[model samples]
Target: MKRALVIGASQSLGSHLATRLASNGWQVVGTGRRPASEVPGSEGFAYERLDLSDPEEAHRFLEGAGSDAYDLVVHNAVTYGAIPGKPPALDELEAMFRVNALVPYRLLHGVLAAQPTDRFCSCVVVNSDSIYHATKQSAPYAATKAALRVLTTSLADTFRSAQVSVATLLLGPLPDPRKLADFQRVAERHDVPVEDVKRAFLRKANPFYVIDDLIGFDACYRSVEYLAGLGPAGNGMVCRLDGGSAGSLI
Candidate 1:
């Protein structure tokens, strides 16, 4: 069976992708900051505790994983620091940068180094659509994502000769319960109506509002699978999975 490694598989999109990959007969190893006991729906795959915020922990994990090669690797871990409107401290920004971009670079470097001479590897980096549009509140988060995109492109170029392909999936907002709850909390804190906050979020995510519903996990899975299946031909590709929101303005 082909082996796949999913970084940040504790919850939300990461968990869904891990489960789906296992169901498809792939031997999957998933990493998350949460303990295995705390993570739900982790029956089919192996879970490892990986906290990307600490440089020492991240370096240790990379060092240990340097010899283990995976046919498919997905970097899905991210941290959005300080919630919007609040300026993040220097340490917070550093942590966010590490989790959002730097850790991924190290992880991919180790994985690609261990790839077998004759084996092919497909690597997917999950980014956000916020990179295209600017938001004062989310400017810091968007900067990290933009940095990730540049790193992914460079990786694609550097590893092309080694039979390793890298692609970036620029995803839009999804209906994650956790994020919805966060919005509610923010609205309450700011003394604004929850519905107004939701409406504002939707409008910002998709100015055209062409699609009534947010993008689902199934769609994201399909996009990732499709890109992986493309092999080396999809190298350096940046795919937008934002339900046509980014291009609607064109």
Candidate 2:
């Protein structure tokens, strides 16, 4: 029974992944701002409140947890919006950069350094295709995920000796309340039914299952398991979640 740490376990997507892993016999430790007594499939799993926005706080917390040699580390915690009220572009950029890039960039080394050489472990950095799009509502957010993608790849190079793996899960439309509500509010204000917005975001344009589906997490776990079994060093792989599940979107 290997241990796994998830930084954004409160998110629907993270919660789904954590539960799946726990059901499969992994010791799931989840961190989030609002710690639930328990979530689906995580009966006795550990839950902690973590505000990783403060990099130093995150560093200290990780250093103190003492599960340094865990089998898997998922750096999926992230802040998606611009500063409250959608601050000036520069200010928003500053905040997003820290949450999306700098913290994980440095923490990867600390977490990896804590791990042992014998186990085949990997880190998955969840990303958004917003990084590849133009004039995204949250360009800074996109930039940060892109940065993580680059960092994950570079970190893989360093893990050659320890045989650890690093990967980027370029995620698409998330089906969580946060994003769906965002769509709902905007659609309502503009005199459009929320269903229309949902259709575009998930059914046609994106055509993928949202974060709550957990299918992507299943794929993620399998990919890591496979990568870890190999002797380290493999090309980065890209996976899409919803392709034909478009009918399930609305």
Candidate 3:
């Protein structure tokens, strides 16, 4: 069986991907900051608690036994630093960068180091289409993703001789129900209508909002599966799964 490790598999997209991969016969191991019992879809695969914000914890997990026994590794964990109307605090920005960019770099470096040079492994970093455009609300978040993209490219080049393939999957806004619920809670906290909060959230989240532009979990799974199947051929590929919402200027 093909083994895969999915980081941050507690979130909506990550949960869906992990479940799908398990259903498709992959021996999947998923990591999340939350405990397995607290995660909704925890039964689909083996679960590990990994706090990406803590460097020492992440380092220990990476160096643990059987860390390099995977054909695919997907870095799906991310932290948003958008404070709306103003930039995030310096400390918050640093935290966001650590989770979004540095964690993946460390995770991949540790995994690759343990793998045999002759073995093949595929790594996918989930990024955002926000890196392709400018926006005040999510500027800090976008900056971190941009840094991740560049880091993926550098890793791909550096690990070419080891038969390790790295790809960045740039996704647009996804119609995750959890986001709407979170927005509703925010509205309640501020004594605003849910619809109004929803509108504002969507406006900020989907800057290039064309009808039917939101990418689905299935589409993302297929993209990742295809990239993983490519082995060495898909190294350094930046696959944009945004349904063309990030339009070309050229």
Candidate 4:
């Protein structure tokens, strides 16, 4: 049986990916900020508590998780918010970078250290198109994700001969219910109608929004599965699933 570890499996796209993997007959282990009781119907897979904001705890979790020798690992955890026209505070910036950039860097190293010398492991990082197309007031979040994309690319080279592969699945918007609240909040803060927000989002220049037709959770799940299915040496390559809009990555 193929075993996989999914980082940040608590909500949004992460939660969707975890459930899909479990249903597909994979022994899936996932991480969240709290215990499994917080997740509804978590019986299909196992859970590990992880708080990426705490560096020491994150390292420990990655080390322990790596020792399990998972065939695949999917990283989908992120923390960020946007307040237009204002710079983020130092603490918030630090937290965003830690989760988006630093954690993934350490995760790769820890997993590599723990795996058997000859075993192959595939890693997929869910990345945003924000790196190529920055949105209003999302500088900190965009910068960190850009760092993660670069870091994932660099690690692929470091592990080339170790039979390990790492790939970045650059993604666009999906119809996640949770993000409705975020859209509402941003709209309220900006004192604009929600339609204005939606209009701005329809612009292919924005990183988070895609065409309405391609905005579903299933597309994201299938994209991730396809990335994980690629053979070795597919490492460092980028696969974009941003609803057919190249978003300048092409």
TM-score of each: 0.89, 0.76, 0.87, 0.85
Error of 2 at 207 (Å): 11
Spell out the clash pairs found in candidate 4: none
Range of the 10 consecutive residues with the lowest summed lDDT in candidate 4:
205-214
Best by lDDT: 1
Candidate 1: 10-residue stretch with minimal lDDT: 205-214
Off by over 4 Å in 1: 182-200
Candidate 4 lDDT, 114-147, residue by residue in tens: 7666667888888887776675577788899999
Off by over 4 Å in 4: 82-85, 181-200, 204-210, 244-250
Clashing pairs in 1: none
- TM-score for candidate 2, please give it: 0.76
Ranked candidates, highest TM-score first: 1, 3, 4, 2
Counting clashing residue pairs in each candidate, in order, gives 0, 1, 0, 0
lDDT of 2 by residue, 112-165 (tens): 777877776767667666666524355566677778778777787677567577
Residue 21 of model 2, lDDT score: 75
> Runs in model 2 with CA error above 4 Å?
37-43, 83-89, 182-196, 202-236, 240-250
By lDDT, rank the candidates, best first.
1, 3, 4, 2
lDDT string, candidate 3, 1-106, tens digits: 9888899898789999899999999988899898898876779889999888899888889877337588888989988765667778888899999999988897
Error of 3 at 144 (Å): 0.6
- Model 1 deviation from the true structure expressed as Cα RMSD, one decimal place: 3.0
